[model samples]
Target: MLLLVAAVGILAVVGFVTFLKLSPQSTPISSQPSTSTKEVNALSLYHWWTSPGESAAINSLFGVFKNSYPDVAIIPAPVSGGAGFQIFPLIQSLVNAGEAPDAFQMHAGYEARPYYDAGLLEPIDALWQSEKLESVIPKVIRDMTQFDNHYYSIPVNVHRVNVVWYNQKLLKQNGIDASRLTTWDSFFAACDKLKAAGVKYPIQMGPTWTASHIFEQILASQGVSFYENFINGKILSAQDPTLNQALTTFKKFLSHVNPDNSTTVKDWDDAIRRIIKAEGAFSIMGDWANGEFKLIGMKHNTDYGTIPVPGTNDMYGLCIDTFQHPKAASHPTNSDRWLKVVASKAGQDAFNPIKGSIPARTDADVSLYDDYQKGAISDFNKSTYMYPSIVHGSGMPSSFKLKLNDIVDNFVQTQDINKAAVAIVNQIQSTLPEFTKVWSLE
Candidate 1:
C-alpha cells in the first residue's frame, strides 16, 4: 500500500510539471502599465506630409525599414494642414495628453527647440554616431540636428529657399534673357521689362508665409550672416545699417510686385497659377515650389527656369524636415531602432526624390533628379554660404512668429516703406528679448 501511494505521488508530481511546461503562463499583472520589450512589430508616425508626392517620398523610407526590420510595420498618421500653423498645435495637444506618437516630423529650427526643452524628445546622438551619419550628411545639415552637442532630430533634406521660378514663355516673348539677370540690378531690370510688356502682375506674392520667405531670401542674399546675428539677438540695434539696407532693398522689390497683390492673391497656389498662365512673370520661392510646377506638367528650364535670388553668391538656406522620436516607455527600444534607420543612407535615397528636396546627405547621388532638382543639388554641392531659413530658424517663439505675421500684414497694406521697416525693427527688438531668454534656459 505504501509503494502504491508513493507511485501515485510521483505520477502526480510528474503530471503537474508536465502541465506547467505545456500550459500558457499568465503575464505578471502589475499596477503599473505594461512596458513592451518585445521586438517592435508596429509603430505610429505623425506628420504633415500628406501631399501625394510627399507621401510617396516618405513611403520609400518605410519600404527600406520593412526590408531591414521585416517584422516591423510603420503606420503613418498624417495630419493635414499648414505645417507651422496646424500640425504643431495638434502635436502640442497630444504631448500634453500623454498620447504622442512613437515618432513625428519636426522642422529643424528654433521651433523644434521648444519640444526638446519640454523633455518630450528622445535624443538620437548615439545612434547618429553609431551610424556614421556625419560621413554621409553635410556638416551644415548635421549641425541643424544638434543642439548642445547632442542630436535631437534626423535631417531628411536641404531646401534651397532663395530661388526664383520664372515663366519661360513670357521671358522669351519679352526678349529677356534669364541668364543675363544674375545680379539684383539685372533682376529688377527684368521685372521692369516684364511690367512694361503689359504683364498684369510682374511678380506675384501672397499674404501667407511665402511673403516672409521672400523677405528672408532678400535679406540672406544681401548678407546672411548679418541677418543671422540679428535673428539670434547678437545684433540688437534696430538701426543697424545692414538691416536698413536690407529693408531698403525689400521696399524697392515690393514696388515691382502687383499693386493689388493684397486683394488679388490668397496663397502659394494662387501665385503658382498666376505665374503658370504668364499672368505673372516670376515668383520668388523655395525649391519645393517646383513640385507644384511639375504637377501641372510644366517642362522645367523650358517652360520655366530656376535661378538663385539676385545678389546671392551661391548661398543656400537650409529648410530641413526632420523626424524626432517621442519619449515613450512602452516602445523605447523600437523607437530607438527606427530612428537609426531614418538617419541611414537608404532613408535619404528613398525620401528626398519624392519629397521634392535634395538629400541632406552630401554623398547622395542626385542623378535621378530632373534638371531643376539637379540644378538645386549642384548649387547645394558648390554652396559655400549656408544659413538657416528665417521662417524656421531665428530662435523666436511661436508667439513672435504670429506677431511678425501681423506686422507684415500691416506693412503690406500700408505700403509705407519707412514705417513698415521701422515697425519690423521695433518688433524684432521687442521679440528678441523673449527668444533670448528662452534660448538661454538651455
Candidate 2:
C-alpha cells in the first residue's frame, strides 16, 4: 500500500564502487585531463547530472563560470547515475589513487560525513566569511554544510521533498478535492472513490526506491521530532505503536498504487507520466517533476497542481545539492573559482530555474522562477521547520539508506506490516553506531 514519493538518493555505496572504476566506459574522468595544468587553466568537475533537465541546469552554471573565467577551460566530468551513486564510489577510488578531481557535487548534510572523516575534503569557512554567505543563507542550511563548526560546502539548490503532484483535471473529473484530501484518512477515502469509479490504481508508483522514498514521507508525517529520532537511530522496535502505525499507513497507501502484475513503472518519472496520461490521479514526487510538466507545455494549477504531501503543509523536507573542493584537487585555484561561481547568486539563479528547485540563496529573483517554484520558495521561507531527507541521502548513513529501498520493496510485495516494522527497527539498531551526526531539526 506504500506509495507517493521522492528520489535522487542512491547512497548506493561501496559494493558498486570497485566495478565502476574497473570499467573504462563507466569511469567518469581523471583529475588532470592532460589538457590543462595551472589552477586557473582548467578544472575537472565530477558530478552525476547526465539527464536532459539536469544537464541543461548544470550547463547554465557552466555558462556563468565561462563568462567570468574566459581563458580557463571548464572540463566537465559527469557520471551517468541518479544522485551520484556511481560518482561517489568513483571519487573514493580517485582520492585513494591521488587523482581526485578539482571539485565534485555532493548532498548538503550526511553525504559529506564519510569524506570529511577520511580527510578527503578541505574546509572553506574563510570563503563563507569573505562572501558574507552566513548572513544570507539560512542557518539550518549553513549548519548542514559545516562539520565540527566549520563550513565545507556551498549549497546551490534546494529541492522540497514533501510535495504531492496531482493532475488537476484528473482530480476534477473524479470529483475529488485535492485540497480537502490533506490527511491520510481523506486521501484513502478519495482512493476508495477512484477505485469504485473504475480507476484501478488511483496512485502511481515506481521502482523500489520510490517506495522507500514514500516511507520516509509517511514517517515524517508523524512529526518532525519523530523523524529526528528516526534519523538519529532512536526508533528500534516493532512494538512501538507509532512505528507500526506508520508501517500500517504505508501498507494502506500501497493498496492504491498500480499493481505490479498488470502494470509497472520504469522509474519515478514514469509514474509522474501516468498522471499526465490520466492513468492515475496522483504522484508524490519532488518538484523536478514540475520541470517535466513544464517541458510538455503543461500549466501549473491548470493542468497540474502541487501540495505538501498530506499533513506536511507547514514543513519543508529539504534535499539540497552542494559542491565541495577536495583535499588533493588537481586544480585548487580553479576549484576555488568554481566554488565561488557556485555560491554566487547568479549561479543559483541560472541553475535552479532549469533544475526545477528553488535557489538556495534567500534573495532569489522571483521573476525568473515559475508559479510552482515561487510557491515552493514562499513555503520554504516561512516553513515551520526543515528536515533533511533520508531518501535523498541527507538524513541517514549510506548503509541504512541502501537497505531501506529493499526493505520497502519487500514490504510492498509481501504487505507484511509486522515483518517490515521489525526489519526497519533491526536495521536501525544495527546501523545506529554509524549514524554519528545528531540532527536537531525540530
**Residue-wise C-alpha lDDT for candidate 1, range 205-323, written one tens digit per residue:** 86557677787777776665665565565655556677677767777777877765556775565676788888888888777777777766788888988778887766777788888
Number of clashes recorded per candidate: 0, 4
| Candidate 2, 1-442: lDDT as tens digits | 0011122212323433211122222223444445563333666777776656677889999999999997766656666545555666677777878777778889887778888888889999888988889877988889889999989999998999888888898789889888897788998998899889888998998777777778889988888888888999998778988888889899899889988622466567788888888898888877777777876788999999888888787889998888988887877888888998999999999998888899878887989999999988889878988888997878999778878877888888999988988888899988888987888876
Candidate 2: residue 34 lDDT (0-100)? 58
TM-score, per-candidate, Cα-based: 0.81, 0.88
Model 2: residues with Cα > 4 Å off, grouped in runs: 1-40, 260-264
Candidate 1: which stretches are off by over 4 Å? Answer: 1-33, 36-41, 50-52, 66-74, 80-83, 234-238, 258-266, 329-334, 394-399, 433-442
lDDT of the candidates, in the order given: 0.68, 0.81
Q: Where does candidate 2 clash, by residue pair?
A: 1-253, 1-254, 1-255, 2-254
Highest TM-score model number: 2
